[model samples]
Target chain A: MAEHAPSAKRIQSETDALIAPGHTLASITEKIASLALKRRTPLGWFVGFGISFLLLQALLYTLAVLLFKGVGVWGINVPVGWGFDIINLVWWIGIGHAGTLISAILLLLRQDWRTSINRFAEAMTLFAVACAVIFPVFHTGRPWLAAYWLFPYPNTMGLWPNFRSPLIWDVFAISTYGTVSALFWYVGLIPDMATLRDRAKSKAWKIVYGMAAMGWRGSARHWHNYESAYLLLAGLATPLVISVHTVVSLDFAAGVIPGWHATIFPPYFVAGAIYAGFAMVLTLSIPLRKAYGLEDFITMKHLENMAKVMLATGLIVAYGYTMEAFMAWYSGNPYEKFMMANRMGGPYAVFYWLLILCNVLAPNLLWIKNLRTNTTFLFLISLVVGVGMWLERFVIIPVSLHRDFLPSSWGSYAGTRYDWSAFLGTIGLFLTLFFLFIRFMPVISIFEMRTILPEGEGGEPKS
Target chain B: MRRRGTGTPDIHGVMAEFNTPHDVVEAAHRVHAQGYRKVDAYSPYPIEELSHALGFHHSPLPLLVLLGGIFGLVAVYGLQYWSAVIEYPMNIGGRPLHSWPAFVVPTFDGTILFASLTAVLGVLALNGLPEPYHPVFNVPTFALASRDKFFLCIEARDPKFDRDKTRDLLRALPGVVDVVEVEH
Candidate 1:
């Protein structure tokens, strides 16, 4: 609340509003819910959605080709046996971390600014996780069996998944992460769903939202239970956000490769995940808050806080890179030294420098408070960070794998046409899902917004 | 919970609207003090301390999750041991069959999985949710409970069931907008 504290007379004079000026709780529901119910589709939404849909179709096409031609359609042959598929899997999974950080971690830390963005961010987490799992399953070449084989169910074949393998651990980590994130997201949506149910204009939408709300009556008893459950979920989810990416990094580090075998990976991966995740959040929120005219809810204060997080996490990621280089030299091992030298000056040198530029240099702009507060600058910088994070994965995976212990075994690799399609297509799929989410659900948690209003104003912002 | 008879106009309670969450908390305290046992307060968001004032002071969620997490830790760790060590074993790098060190990651994951699921199910079951309908929704303006308003519903089943006295009690509260009959 931005309200000036009252004197003994208790005049209810307003200070600056936290949400858009003059929008009461009633109008908040009307404004957000109407976008769905009224179905006044914006041209920008169509243009964005159309492109994403096309990319999604392209992804599907590539999948069909992959299924038909087998893993041969990709560039992972012999030495470079983990190409764009693994890169994408790591990328999407890393992207999912930001949502959990916002919704669960920030909630535990009592950061209320997250209320404006947490709902959609959790939705982003779910979608990104959804995009992520597609790669590993399809990469297995037989997804149907890989799906069941990945789990440890008793079978007539008399086999179980290798529990020692990080790949198997990844199956557990990602699936559990997905389940918890989904439940957390849905639990938070209940009261707001009830709000939508009540405010719905049409009978169909009312019933749809009614079922989604699960008869939430806003009772003190219900909120008490709901709040407790939410807090518990947050506590439970906090560890998963760190653990999922740590386990992902283990997939690389557990291997015998010199560059991959490092003690710094777990925390390093976690830091990089947060760095990329915050960047993506900024990328989505800057445009979203502006277009929806939710400038007050997703205030400049909120934007600046996110930039600060990105800066801090980005620096940690940069430190991880430095340590990785230092450790390679400090070890005094030829293979390790070669791996470090290769990363710096090998054929992938262009990508390595680009990664530095995007991940390290671009986020440096946020050090100046003005650049971070500038929406266009933040958007572009965030995009650079997103690309930088991708390149970081590329350098870690394909570049490292392209040449290994034996000179005879060394072979350079490039992603085929199908590989690019799969990667880009998932991006499209992510955006498409995001568009539907923004159009249908309350992107900002409506009920939570009420709590932020100043006292005695009756949930109404003054004009 | 105790539905008095059937059909519409079957009076559930006298529902009153409060201007802000604070006023609702104050009215709830006053009503609870007035020996109204079958009272419930509704707000657009959780009002801190309001639940305790309205006599919903305890929740079993944390305990349920704790127990669930312990059970999950043991169950998942044991399952991995049995699968890798006892049921079928392979000599990959000639490591130990139990591989208890390798079990930690999945065990941590399983604990989270079970704990979170328990929280969701426990909440739903305790709240008696997936309830397609509620009597509160029958109160037409009760929709405002999800928006700007806070409501205090005094069920007719309470011993002090004088409709006029209850209405007067609510109307006397500061910042109360209206008191209306809520029927199922």
Candidate 2:
């Protein structure tokens, strides 16, 4: 059977090709497994885990104190009822948007490069949404009965959650963002789970993977259904991601507070999401590429492409800043002009400057290819951008609302220890989740990788 | 012209393997014309034309999920309205009854939650999940399914299944093998 012999030989060659040279899946699996197992130890993951645990503990203590002591434990006063809590809520919600932008929007665009980062990004979206939902739901004076917001009673107590309230809008935006993101992430994981299922050496691993794969047989019929479902989900998620961020902006836009009532908020917020998202991607990807040695998969080309997007969005955000300034002056609204003037020339001007430095100035370094390719430089810049974006949200929310329509109601705002610690706690939670995700999955879609084979069939660019 | 390997009298069906999905669909048409009504084909990738040859019907999953999501939205909105404005109207900012804009966020979230839940649940229920074990695992080389191997099972569960006739029919085709019954 010459035919049989050649086919047999071909099969062997194919197997060899898959696991050969620097591309051995076994070696990759071993490296990841070793990292994961080590990371489980108190010593290995101590820095991340301990930090997260401590932050969470501090947050719990602070929240308990706040709940027990009432909302007065913080600096929020008459006019600025929505202070650091809402600021942090919007900030976290904004952070959550980036993940879906990478996972859903990039997937729809057919950008294969998104595979390396989408899983972690999607997870980030979920965690960020978790962090977001916390502030709004619990920041209320009576978190114990936050359920009262949802009930439609006919009583004369007059305690109905204002349907016109942007706070109500946020509840919808953040929750929908979280739910849809979770679905998209899980569906994306199924094929990968099947891969793990087929490759596992241990019986326990096999069973775990098998259950997660949901009996994926790699049937043609199943693939058809899977692809269709994915396309449909992508269609839903892309617009949903955009809508979520736009609605988050509306929280400020809907208000009559001088700096908050801007018509340019929707686009501005979206641009900021992409900017912050790309910044975070750079932050994570730089470290990840070096640690996991994924230079080939998450190449400089991908980084550069993302950097260009960052530069564009950064400029747009700068424009939005300029527009807000111009609109204040042009509209001839005395209060609006005074609010914009105060933001630039008043007590919290340091935050405004930091936002400018981090968001506008930091990303300008991307123009230099040497800086873009230098992982260390990219990491530093990313950290700056990330910090800047958070500050941007802080300045937008607290400063704007701290003194709104009437200077009579104006008050100098300051975040308490609880505010600072809760924010730090969220950072810990985000890092812990990110680290765990990188350890388990390939961090890159293995199937999607195959499609990118430079010399393989169907390798040509799609028209 | 039946084979005796399966040790059964009535079983007969042809099996064939093709390198590309295009070849597989072309072969399916030929097999169907040769009166092999019981024949089936499989490939590593989906071949659209083959579905037509196999006469597959429409799936109701999308419609089911959409309807489930709509029901969830109605239920969530109705309950929220009942509780906030109807049962306990605690006025804070002097907002009126039937405050629909404020209801928009929770209603939207509930609708999405319902839709997503339905999609996930529908997929799992339709697929009959928690399938910890399967006979395919017993076929030592079946792991190749994840890679390049293509396979089809004309199960004994099928009405036309016959061991001998299936083997004879399979022999007439190229690269066919075993013709074994998939015992559950």
Candidate 3:
């Protein structure tokens, strides 16, 4: 076996260095599993969880008010029917795209850097989907009815969800995306869960971990099937991720409204989804690595690679913004031209310009090598991109809807307190779930981490 | 739990522990060459070579996933066709009842959903997992199999099994850390 050096200097190259040098398979397991198995809960976790829990309560309260008072409590009004609800729905779902991208797409590309981050990113995908589901459900005013109504269930009313409608397509896409992501995450966790089951000191934890482990014993036969299954999932998820956002964009593209109707929406929306998702991943990973003292696993290389993706996708989004304007003029349709003019200089002009600044200008700073590698700068930029993506959705939805072909129908829309409450509450819900996940589950995949170790590659050990 | 009425304890297998993946793979190759058909190896992560060493090259998981995806495509498309044309046909915007372009999105989703579900569930079913009381776990040191250590267990059910000889053969393998009997 190689000498287990604790103080070895990490390799400097970005491509070659994924995990820091000198980590043994055992050390990797100990480092990752110990976080969940540790007896003492960290104080920072309590503070973070407490704040998010409070926000979650606010979410529940907002839901209660909306359920009782109706969707009228939100800012939905004439000419601007979709308000924060749709904007947030799009934003949250878009944010989830990065998780799938990292887990599935990167794996297919044979990017070993994905190994350390895929587990938590998949978890993020699930949580973001969870947050995304709440908006459309409650936006209907009667979630109880909307629940059954959304599906093609046999009913005495003899009604079925319109197979042709983009909204119904959304029902299938988002639900399938959420379910597959969950299965992928759980399937990946089983072996690590077995590790935890074996490592748990307490009987209660042992049983809990044992059951979740599903009796995984790291058997060679199991690994054979598991690897094939995981690879096939990655294959399936690649197109599914692209299809999900495409269906989401069709929610607008399929509409006859000026700004909402564009063929560019599908690829544009998919790129923007990936762009936004990577930003959120950066937002979560930076603090997470710091808090857990996990600098070795989630190296600077990972952050730099993510920044490059953001830059590339950010440029694509910029192109998207440019195309929307050019097409508005090129199409020579009065409604399309008017929609573009209204977005740039009208009521919600501030949001449009700010989005340009955040999404276009902010990500351009990543062209600088130092800035991309800087953790603090990357985190701040990720936050900016997040806000920018939300603004992009905001500009697309209500801004475009507020003004149409007729001046008489023109009206502005704004979110009431309930709107803000619900939006922020979902953030709380996302963070709350995230905090619990980090607390209970392995933030990194222990088994996957082991694979990248020096001796993990099956060969004769160097003498 | 122990078997009743037998003076001798029920033996599951003899397991050899190794420190590195290479050692385990090498040991497994030697064991297989010795005509041990019911041998299995455990490691912290998937090693393609290790599986090949154990003579496990093909997995039925991909075929199952393909079947699952096909089922999803056919089933979802049929449901849409039946619902739209046969059950409750509504002419919205003069579009035909069989709007295949519109049906594509849901069909794609169902294909992925079913394929992914099958991949996960099928792998679990194939592995004979959720057997919490596996005989391998009877060995206390076996816990390290999920961490750093590598283990190769030749089951007693293998026709060529001779406890003392198997233990001696495993001990003779290069880099073998320890050899122990696994109890059922």
Candidate 4:
């Protein structure tokens, strides 16, 4: 027997004691099973999953009706050709931003604590992308013809997708973003799966986990391969995280839309995506830690770190808004100035205020150390920020389009019941996918977290 | 030294426990000096020096992803050009016969597709996915890997592995216990 070294003690208390060295599979399994049974399904998880499913169903029905009938089911008219659908598309895509940011950007910065939440965040990125993709495909008014958007296929229509068009850029960016994210998420799962595999007692469970682990022997060679691949993917994803949102923003920027035509759209959109993404991470993580018994693993320090990132991005988003206002005033274009005014002072003033409050003001609470570290307060603020970000998108899209050029063409567009239903349904879809993910997979990267633990003072990774 | 019924060595591999990373690095250096080639090191997190000490090699994943992305760019551009320019050249807005700029979206999309494909394929290939079995699960205590235990396997299959010598070598190192040979 190896001499027991008390070096790796995870001591929360003397009485509770550190985890015993070489704790048996039986004991771990028994603990997990007991925890699973003892712990109540978190209310947030219930609400998030339940509502997301319901909303998903409504979205499906709306899509069915839209597909069978036409895009007329949407409130899109001539000038406002992109109504709820585009807004949802942009919003969902924006929501996905935080996932990539958490998984990739933080990874590059050598922020090991990111491991605790990166897996789930990455999953969220994929699902949010799945949700985002639904809108653009349906928005085409002919979902079957989405392949047409892929290229100027050798069809009767002579138009290859206009490279000159940002919409086409979007199809590329979004699809790529979703695909790469999903890959990253799944690949990241392997080591953790091996952990689960090694931990499984039943032969059936063993087989299932064994297959997922993909014969991981924890060979130094394998680890080397795995680490390099992961780093490369992270590198690839870093650019993608920025580029995808930047391109998405260009969908508006490349056009003649006054407020959208600014040079700052790329960085601005990226910042907003990260802001929304961080808000979402908080929204999900706060409750998950309680539900999954991962508080120790995903410590308050982690939350504070995330909140700081959120606050920084929030400031950036606020700056972007300021720039837009300043640019509108400075550009001396009536339409540009008018669009800027419409965003802040027009009929969509409420939405604008909500956006500012949620994205800008709410995160400022993090400035206070106590507020940032308080899990419950952090969670509530996260939810507020999440809602605020959605409104931010709402204000950015329809509000801008609602009163475009001609006042005669301008009629205030309010979201119909269908729009609200679809939005809620999308939420349901996101939660349902999330719930399933948590139930099956270890939400934290067990392997990565071990690496992040302080070898000594200062939680610096042993490496 | 013992041999199991399966004709494999009955050594259960060395288990080195360390309090801090520096200790592990020092221990690795000592183990290396002892000329044990089959030994491995496990830690809670990756230690770059330890990885080097353990003789880690570079992964081929970056090249794979790069190629995948390049392929995507080419395929998407080619498809768009073939479909629009060569197959059905319909002039809109007095555009040129072959519009390269117009192909950027699809080309860009294809690049993403390729990159994503690489990621998935790279992961699958690197991890040896869909593998239904392995020998590590045979060790019951191995499950502690997730929570606390860091282990090293000096597999019997390694060319330098001599059950008696490897076990003797590992047993000599501080913090090492139960140097059992792992069988596949």
True contacts kept of each: 0.85, 0.37, 0.91, 0.46
Ranking by TM-score: 3, 1, 4, 2
RMSD of each: 4.3, 7.2, 3.4, 6.2
lDDT-best of 1 and 3? 3
Model 1's A-chain: what TM-score? 0.94
**Fnat of candidate 2, please?**
0.37
Q: Tens digit of lDDT per residue, candidate 2, span A331-357?
A: 999988888888888889999988889
Error of 2 at A290 (Å): 1.8
TM-score of chain A of 3: 0.96
Candidate with more favorable, higher DockQ: 2 or 4: 4
Question: Measured with DockQ on alpha carbons, how good is candidate 3?
Answer: 0.72
Q: After superposition, how far is residue B5 of candidate 3 from its true place, in Å?
A: 19
Candidate 3 regions with alpha-carbon error over 4 angstroms? A1-16, A456-463, B1-9
TM-score, one value per model: 0.94, 0.82, 0.96, 0.84
Model 4 backbone overlap count: 19
Interface RMSD of each: 2.2, 4.5, 1.8, 4.3
Name the candidate that leads on lDDT: 3
DockQ of 1: 0.64
Candidate 1 lDDT over A1-463, as tens digits, reads: 3344443223221212245556566676667667566657889999999999999998999999999989999998989999899999999999899999999999999987788889888999999999999999999998987855699898888898889899999999999999999999999999989988888888999999999999999898898899999999999999889999999999989998877899899999999998888888999999898888877678777788889999999999999999999999988999999999999999999999999999888888889977877889988988899999999999999889988788999999899999999999999999999999998899988888776665544552222
What is the TM-score of candidate 1?
A: 0.94
Docking class of 2: acceptable
Cα error, residue B168 of model 1, in Å, equals: 3.6
Candidate 1: RMSD to truth: 4.3
Model 3: how far is B115 from its true place, Å?
1.0
lDDT of 2 by residue, B87-168 (tens): 6565757777677766766676676667767766666565455466655455555564454444544434344545666546
**Segments of candidate 4 deviating more than 4 angstroms:** A1-51, A151-160, A456-463, B1-45, B73-90, B95-116, B123-130, B145-147, B155-167, B170-173, B181-184
